[model samples]
Target chain A: MSIRNKYEEELTTVFNKLIAMCRTVEIAIEKSVNSLVHRDTELAGEVIKEDKNVDNLEHEIEQDCLKILLMEHPVASDFRDVSAALKMITDLERIADQAADISEITFQFGEESFIKEPFHIKEMAKLATGMVKDSVQSYINRDLELARSLDRRDDGVDNLFGKIKGELVELIKKDGRNADQAILFMMIAKYIERIADHAVNIGEWVEYAITGYHKIG
Target chain B: MKDKKQTVKDNLDIFDFTSDIAVNIKSLNLYYGNFQALKEVSMELKKNEITAMIGPSGCGKSTLLKTLNRMNDLVDGCRIEGSITIGEKDIYAKDIDLSALRKNVGMVFQKPNPFPMSVYDNVAFAPRTFGIRKKAELDEIVETSLKRASIWDELKDRLNKSALGLSGGQQQRLCIARSLAAQPKILLMDEPTSALDPISTGKIEELMSELVKDLTIVIVTHNMQQATRIADRTAFFYLGELVEFADTQTLFTCPADKRTENYITGRFG
Candidate 1:
C-alpha cells in the first residue's frame, strides 16, 4: 500500500461523516417546519430526538480532525481541509440545535392554529435548508463560485425574515389578543433566519478552505 | 597573497551595504556534466529571515543551498550559470575571493563536525586564523559565539574538554557556534538536524530561530515539519524546477501549484 493510504482513508471517513451530518440537519429543518405546518406533534418530537444523532456525528468528526492533526502533521491543502472541517462542524451543530429549538416551540403551540398562514416563514425554512446542503456540497467539491453564490441566497432569506417580522407586528397591533401567537411565530421566523446565517458561515469557511480568504473578521 | 588579502577585505566591507535582501539569484541554472540539476531558479532571500528549500531526494534543494556558498565549486564536474548577488557584490565575479565569500556565508553540514580540538579552541579557530592573537579578544569571541548558539550555559565549564566527547546535540550546537564565530552575513544549513534525536532537533530549530535575528538563513531540509516550524518562506522544488515559493503559511495551506500540493500532502510517489 502507498504511504498515505491510511491517511486518505481516515480523511474520507471524516468527509463521509460530514455529509451524513449535513443530511441529518437538513432533515431536521424540514421536519420541524412540516410538523408546525401540518400540526403533526409526532414529527416535531422526532426532530427533537434525532438531534442527539447530529450531536454525536459532530463529536465523531471533531475527534477525527484532531487525530489527523496530531498524527499526520498535515500540511498545505491537507492542513486547510482539516482546520476548515473543524470550523464547519461547529456551524452544523448550531444548525441542528436551532432545528430542535423550532421543534420545541412547535410543542408550545399545542393544537392551536398559527396566528398566520406561516407562508413567508415556511419559505424561509426551505431556503435556509437548501443553503445548508449546498454549503456542505461546496466544501466537499471545493467550489468557489457555488460558495460565493450562497451569500446572495442568504440575502433572500433575510428579506423574507424582515417581511415576516413586519407582518407579525401588524397582526399584534390589529388585536391585543393576537400578541401571544404573534410572538411565537416571530420566534420561529427568527430561528429560521439564524439557520440561514449559519449556512452562510459554512460557505465562508469553504472559501477559506479553498482560497484562505474569509469574508469577515 | 597580500593583494588577495586586500581584495578579501574589500569584499568584506561591501557587506555593510544596507538592503532588505541578503541574497538574490537571477535565472540560476546549475549542471553536473551533462545532467541539469537546477533550471531557471530565481529567488530573493530576505535579510534576517529563514527560507527553507524542500523537495524529494535529488530534486536540487541541497544543490541550491550549496550554490549560496559556492560549495559546489569543490565538485569536479559541477558548472553553474547566472548571477548570484550577495548584498551588492556578485559572488561569481572573477575578482571575488572564495575565502572571503565562504567567511561571509557560513555553512553547517547534515552531521555535527566539530574539530578534534577543545570547545574553546573550536569556537576560537576562525578568529585566530583571521589574525587575532590576544587571548582576551579570543576569550570574548569564544564566549559570545557559544552564547549566541545557545549552548554556552551547558558547555561553559567544559571549555577545555575535547568537542568529540560531547553529545550529538551539543556537538551540533558547537558547530553552530563555530560558524557564528566567523560572523557570517548568511548561514546555509543542509539538513542540520536530520542525524540528531528529536530533542536535539528541537534545540537546533530553536537556535535557528534565534540566530535569524542577526543572519539570513537558507536551509535545505527533507523534514517538512521542520521547514514549516522555523522558515518564514519556503520553496518547493521538483525535478530541477521550482514548483512553488510562498509564505510558509500559504504554501502549506493552499499552494498555487498542484504539484506542490501533492508533494506537501504526501500524495505524490
Candidate 2:
C-alpha cells in the first residue's frame, strides 16, 4: 500500500475505536443514571468499571492521532479531521468521567432507597446522551449544521438544570429530614449538566474539523 | 485610504521595469462571492524566467497565479475585472478561447493529483486530449516530458504501473511532466514541494532550474530556501497587496520592504 493509504487505514482504525469508546460511554451513562434513580448498585458498579475501559481507549486514540501529526504532516481537510478527533476525545473522556461520578454517588447510597423522583436528573441524562450521540455523528459525517446546533440544545439543558436547583431548594425547605439526600441529588444533577456541556465542546470540535473554526452556532 | 500609506507607495513607485514582459497586469481586481482578494494589482512577469510569488497565507499570490491561466474561471461566483494580457493579448477578451488559453498556460497544485491513472497514461493523457495520436508520438512525448521533469530514469521501467504506486515526490514530478506534455508557454506551480520530503523537494528544485531554459515559470512558495534556489525574480505580497518585486538575490539579501525582510528572516509571516 502507498504511504497515504497506510496513514488513511490507521486513521480509520483509530477513528472507529474513538467512536466505539463514545458509544460505550453513552450506554454506561444511560444505565448508570437509571441505576441512580432506580436504586440499582450493581449497574452503577458496571458503569464505573466501563469508564476505566473508556479511559484506555481515549489514551490509545490520542497517541495514534499524535503519531499522525508528528509523522505525516497532513493538511487541508485531513488535517482538520485529525485535530478535531483529538479535541473530541478530550470531551468524550470528560463525559465518561461524569458517568463515573454518577456511579460513585450511586455506590455511596447503596443501602438507602432512591426516595426522590429524580425526574429532572433523568431528563438531564437523556439530553446529555443525545448531545454525545449527535456530536459524534456530526464528526463522522462532517455535518456542520448539526454540530453547531448542539449549542442551542445546551441552553435548554442549562435552563432545566437551573429549574432542578430551585426545586431541590424547595424540597429542602419543605422537610428537614430529606435535606442531605436532596443536596446529594443536586450534585448528581450538576454532573449530568456538565456532561452535556462537554458534549457541546465535542460539537464545537466537529465544526472545527469541517470548517477550521471553533465557534458553535 | 490614508495619506501615510500613499507616501509609502510613492517610494515603491521609484522601482521600475523597462523591458519585454510575458504577462502585464493593468489594474486587475478579483472577487469571490462578495469579498475582494486582488485589489487593482499590477505587475509584470519577465519572459522565460522563474518568478517566485512569496507571501503569508491568503495574500492573493495564488489568486494572482490562477488569474494568469484563467483558472479563476473554474470557481463559481469568481469575477475578474480589468485587463490581464498574456503575450500582449487580453486574456479576458470576449473572443479569447479559454481552452486555448489554458493550452498556453499550465498549473501544478500544492498537492500532487496524478489523476488516478498509470504512470505512462498520466503524461500522455493531456497531449492525447489535445489531439496528439499514434503510438510513436505518445511514447516520444512521455519520454521527453519525464526526462524534462527529471523522473524518466526512475519511472522509465514502471511506465505501465499506476501513478498511485509511486512515491510522493515521484508522483508530484509526474504531475509536472503531465503539465509539460501539453507544451505550455508558461507553467504556474502553487507550492509544489510543500507536500514532499526534503530530498524530493531538492530533486524538484533541480528539475525547475533545468526547465527554466525553455519556459516562463511563475511559482508560489512559502519556503524562502526553495525560492533562492530556483527563482530568478521574486514578488512579495501581504494582505492582498503586492509589496515589492525584485531580483531573487536582491530580494532575499536586501529587500526594500520591511515586511518582505521580516518574512524572509524568520521574524514574521
Candidate 3:
C-alpha cells in the first residue's frame, strides 16, 4: 500500500475523471464529424446535447484538483499533475465546444447535396479525432515522446484544412451557386482544424505533467 | 495598465539577488555514542534568508539544527566532526567560546519555554545575564526585542505579568523576543510552530518572514507547507543524509532528485 493512501486515491479519481472527460470529448468530435458526413441531424443533436456531460465532468475534475490542493497541499510531481489536469481540462472543454459548434452548423445544411465530396475535410476529421485520442493516451500513460509528437501530427490536419479551403474556393469559382454550401463546408473544416489545435494544447499540458517543461509561454 | 505592469516589475525587483553566506557547514558528521545522527551534511545558509530543513522524524534534521549552536554538546557521549564556520571562526575550535557562540546563534525549541518570570524580565534575562544592569538599558532592550518579535503592543500593558500567564502563542512570541534580546546573528528554530494553532502558526510564520530581513534563520519543520510558504531555500534530509538542497520554489514544484520528489509528494515510505 502507498504511504498516503487517501491522497493517492483522490489523485487517481481526478485522473480517471480527466480521462473520462477526454473520452467524451473524442466521441463528440467523432459524432459531430459523422453527422456532417452522413447529414444525420439526430447524431448532431446528440453531440450538442451530450456536451453538458463533458462540462459537468470538467467541473467535477476541477473541484477534485482543488480539493487535493486545499487538503493535501500536494507538491513536486503531484503538484504538477494537478496543475496540468486543470490546464488540460480547459482545452478539452474547448474541444467539446468546437465539436458542438460544428454540430450547430450541421443544422444549416438540411438535406442539401454537397457542392463537393468533402474528401479532405473527412481526412482532417479523422486526423483531428486521432490526435485527441493520442493526447488522452499520452496523458494516461504519461508518455512524453507521444505528447511531443502531437505538435508535428497537427501539421497534417492544418495541411488538410488548407487543401479543403483551396478546393472549396476553386469549386465556387466554377459555380457561383455553390458559394453557400462551400462556405458551410469551409466553416466545418475550420472547426476540425481548431479541434486538432486544442488536442495539441492538451498534448503540451501532458508534456508539462510528465516533464515540467511547457512548450508555450 | 502601463503603470500597473511597471509597479509589478518594480515589486519583483525587490528580491535580493546577492547571497551572503552566514553559516557554512562543511562535511559535518554527528554521532551519539556509537550511533550516527548526521552523515556528512554540508550546506551554506544565506544571510538574511530563511532556510528550512524538512524530513521525517528521526532523519537528523533536529540534530543538524542543534549543531548550529552546539546545543548537542549538552548530550551525553555526543561527538561531532567537520567544520561549522560562522564568518571566519570555526565554532568547534578548542579556544571557541560556547557562550558567545550561543549568543550569536540563538535557538527556539519545539515547546515555548518562557522562564517563569515576568514578561519584561523574560525578554531582559539574556541581556541582564550578559551584564546590562542599568534599568534604562534593560528597558530599551526589552522593548526593542518585543517589537522585533511583533508582540510589543499586546504585552506592553502587561509587561510585569508572569510569562506563564500568556497564551501559548504569546508565550512562543515571548520566547522569540527573549532570543532576540541576545542580538543573535543567526536564529535556529526546531519545529517552532508544530505545537501551536493555525492562527498562531500563521503569526509566527509572518514574524519569521519579517525577521529574515535583518537576521538569518534556519528552521527545522515537519510541516512541508510551512517550508513551502515561508522558506527561501529548503534542505531535505533522510536517514541522517542530506538528500537535496534547493530554492523553495524549485524544490516544491519540481525537485531534481527522485527521493526529494517522493518525500515532498508524500510517496516516501
State the iRMSD of every prediction, in order shown: 2.3, 14.6, 1.4
Candidates 1 and 3, the one with greater lDDT: 1
Q: Which docking class does model 3 fall in?
A: medium
TM-score of 1: 0.95
DockQ of candidate 3 (2 decimals) = 0.58
Give the clashing pairs for model 2.
none
lDDT for B171 (candidate 3): 95
Arranged by lDDT, best first: 1, 3, 2
Error at B134, model 1, angstroms: 0.8
Show the lowest summed lDDT stretch of 10 residues, model 3 chain B.
B8-17
Best of the two (1, 3) by TM-score: 1
Q: What's the TM-score of chain A alone for every prediction? A: 0.97, 0.94, 0.97
When just chain B is superposed on the true chain B, each candidate scores a TM-score of: 0.95, 0.90, 0.92
Candidate 3, A27-117: lDDT as tens digits: 9988998898889999999999999999999999999999899998888888988999898899999999999999999999877788877
State TM-scores per candidate: 0.95, 0.51, 0.92
Instruction: Supply DockQ values for each candidate.
Output: 0.63, 0.01, 0.58
lDDT of 2 by residue, B51-149 (tens): 999998899999999999788888999998888888667888987767667767889999999988899999999777766666788999999999999
lDDT of 3 at B142: 96
lDDT of 2 at B144: 98
Q: What's the number of clashes in each of the models? A: 1, 0, 0
